[model samples]
Target: MRILLSVLALMFTLGLTACDMNEGPAEEAGENIDNAMTDAGNAVEDLCEDAKEGMNAEDEDC
Candidate 1:
């Protein structure tokens, strides 16, 4: 029973080692999301500034 358990453990470890595990794609996706959020935030800030300037403009035709 002890030998069987050892063999089973060895097989399980080998199986885990044989599988492919990587974080490259996940890291790239996270970076892309961060860049997108930054761009969106900047765009919104610019839009808000333009709106404020328009609201405060002296011209009545807007």
Candidate 2:
């Protein structure tokens, strides 16, 4: 039917527009910055734990 064909065409167009196959430079740079910040936060947490263990603190949970 014409209605079925129209529905299929609408769905196909939506599907094509929703997919992005390329990653732009700014997006890549943002991802790198996010990763670096996460790494730094983890390193700081580890350092804090190490310092707590070295000091023989009773609560040793960082």
Candidate 3:
């Protein structure tokens, strides 16, 4: 009986862990937003670098 109970507990724990491993909708949306923000930041940096080059600045790196 003890072994059976232990096995059941182990199975239950495994099931819970498996459920937690999958990403939910909210997490997906948050990841998308993060990626978008990163892209936007990179674009802004590129624009800054371009503007600096146009001005013939000493440091063209943004």
Please provide TM-scores, in order, for all candidate models, with all chains considered together.
0.53, 0.69, 0.70
Query: Model 1 reaches what TM-score against the true structure?
Result: 0.53
Best by lDDT: 3
Report the lDDT tens digits of candidate 2 across residue range 1-62: 99999999999999998797798899899999999999999999999999999999997778
- Cα-based lDDT at residue 9, candidate 2: 100
Q: How high is the CA lDDT of each candidate model?
A: 0.83, 0.94, 0.97
Give the per-residue lDDT digits (tens) of candidate 3, residues 1-62.
99999999999999998888689999999999999999999999999999999999999998
**lDDT for predicted candidate 2 compared with the true structure:** 0.94
**Could you tell me which residue pairs clash in candidate 1?**
none
Q: What tens-digit string does per-residue lDDT give for candidate 1 at 1-62?
A: 99999999999999998785665888889989999999999888788778878789664332
* Candidate 2 local Cα displacement, residue 28, angstroms: 0.6
> In terms of lDDT, which candidate is stronger, 1 or 2?
2
Model 1: lDDT of residue 34: 100
Please say which candidate is ahead in lDDT: 2 or 3: 3
Candidate 1 local lDDT, residue 50: 81
